[model samples]
Target: MAEQQTWPHHELGRKLNNWGRWGDDDQIGTLNFVTPATRVEAAGLVRTGKSFDLGMPFDKDGPFKAGGFRTNPQHIMTLLPSDTAHTKDGLISADDMIITGLQAATQWDGLAHAGYGGRFYNNVPAAAVNNFLGATRNSFHHAVERLISRGVLLDIARLKGVDRLEDSYEITEADLLAAEERQGVRVRSGDIVLLRTGSYQWFLEGDREHFLGNAPGPCLDTCEWLYEREVAALAIDNHSGEVWPSPIEGVTIPFHQVVIRDMGLTLGEMFNLEELAADCEADGVWEFLFCAPGLKVTGSAGSPITPIALK
Candidate 1:
């Protein structure tokens, strides 16, 4: 995306990490800043009561392309036969089920989603997460309650005057500040920052290859920015939260190491923010109420979510 800037930039990210910043046995990491008062403060931003949906549709034609390590969701239905279950006695009933990966569509990555050097977030051992009980440590269960707060959108692609950023275009700290200035907004503590790279619009235009694979996004430097800003969570309209083919050689998804693992930040990916961005620009408001809660699937590493932004 940019120069060969390695992740875990010692000057920035390494110092901003929340490793034990909360406690030695912390489950919800940086989310500790999202108190009840924070939600109350966020609710005040809804002047017009307009809402934006941040979730992509869930189905086979999902974000992940063919032959990836993770595939899209699969739907299955089962028919039941019983004296009290059928419509033959003037009763109509049906049941359906979905068997799919948790993070297949618009989803939230849990504390157990990614790690490095045999350690997950808050020094939770990676082995504790991959066990037979299905991610016993730092699972998505801990995130079931802390997904509501203030939401801010920084439309990087719109700032660059492009429908889509070049694949692997690394977003910089200056770009973030410039976006804030242009939008006339200031990111507050416990804000769920939505970094709109316009990948959602590309996915809408049938550019699946670029949206699913070679999408542009932030680099590790942006993780440092997230940390310094005290953001409660991060959502991006791209595949991975960071740029692909990692900025560092021989280190795949290094941004995951710093953002999710080291900093213990909650990450939301594949959110549909095209309408939200347009509405924000038209209404001259970039801050709103962010709300998205996990399914509370015990031991799961991630879960599908439908985030809503109220303006």
Candidate 2:
């Protein structure tokens, strides 16, 4: 008979030997703007009288879609008198909105989600795992209380000009610099860089077959460059930091593994970049972006986000 493995539960020990390789000689510890947001910003880089939901529209056919083993659920009920309180000038509107579904949109990811032996980013010890329930993807990158500084937008899709980024298309370092030079932008250290590949545009148009098929992503050379520049974090309008079906076979997203796992930095996936790109074009510079994600505790990867840019 085979011996059954017992659940360790809370009895975690030293499982972070692999995490030591992620840090560098000068990688900054604390951040400012990239941290989690708890309240609405009274003053920010951009303002709007109406809230343009960054979240993907939640319908069977909405562009922002997530494939998982489970979905969200919710319920709503209305409270009103039988005759509208018998008044023609009721204070409240006649119709109210009630919505319930999977919590498909949230921002959270802890060390427990990745890393070997359950070690987290920065090599946080296994014993420190708390407030995280379920899986590691729910709590992988938590940069709350950190500050994000100036941002740069690298619009690769516009540089390509096919309306959207196709799957398996590799984004090279040349692509990055060409876009930057074309936009007259310079990438600085400790900056939040958003790479717009236009993948989200197709996803929003109900083109699932193509949307999910494959998309553009960076290669190892570009990743090494960004890491060398000491970027705070890098995000994109695609599923991951690397292209699917990989341009070079026998080498899976070596850049992703090297950056996120070996470099100790973070990554943001599934971002909505249309508006941000447009804002960059109008500004004549593809920089000056500002974004802060919601702090959804006890959750894994956040839902879709619609980051904005300012002039």
In the range 1-311, model 1's lDDT, one tens digit per residue, is 78855444433445767888988989777788799999999999889989998998888888677777778888765644453464666775556688788998899888898887688888898779655798887888887788889999999988999877888899888899999999999887788899998878777887777677766888866776788788888999987877876877767877777788888888888899999999998988999998999688989988898889999
Off by over 4 Å in 1: 1-13, 80-89
lDDT of 2 by residue, 198-226 (tens): 87776677685565557787866576567
TM-score for each of the candidates: 0.92, 0.66
True-structure lDDT of candidate 2: 0.53
Whose lDDT is greatest here?
Answer: 1
* RMSD list, candidates in order: 3.8, 7.9
- How big is the positional error of residue 296 in model 2, measured in Å on the Cα after superposition? 3.7
Best by TM-score: 1
lDDT of each: 0.83, 0.53
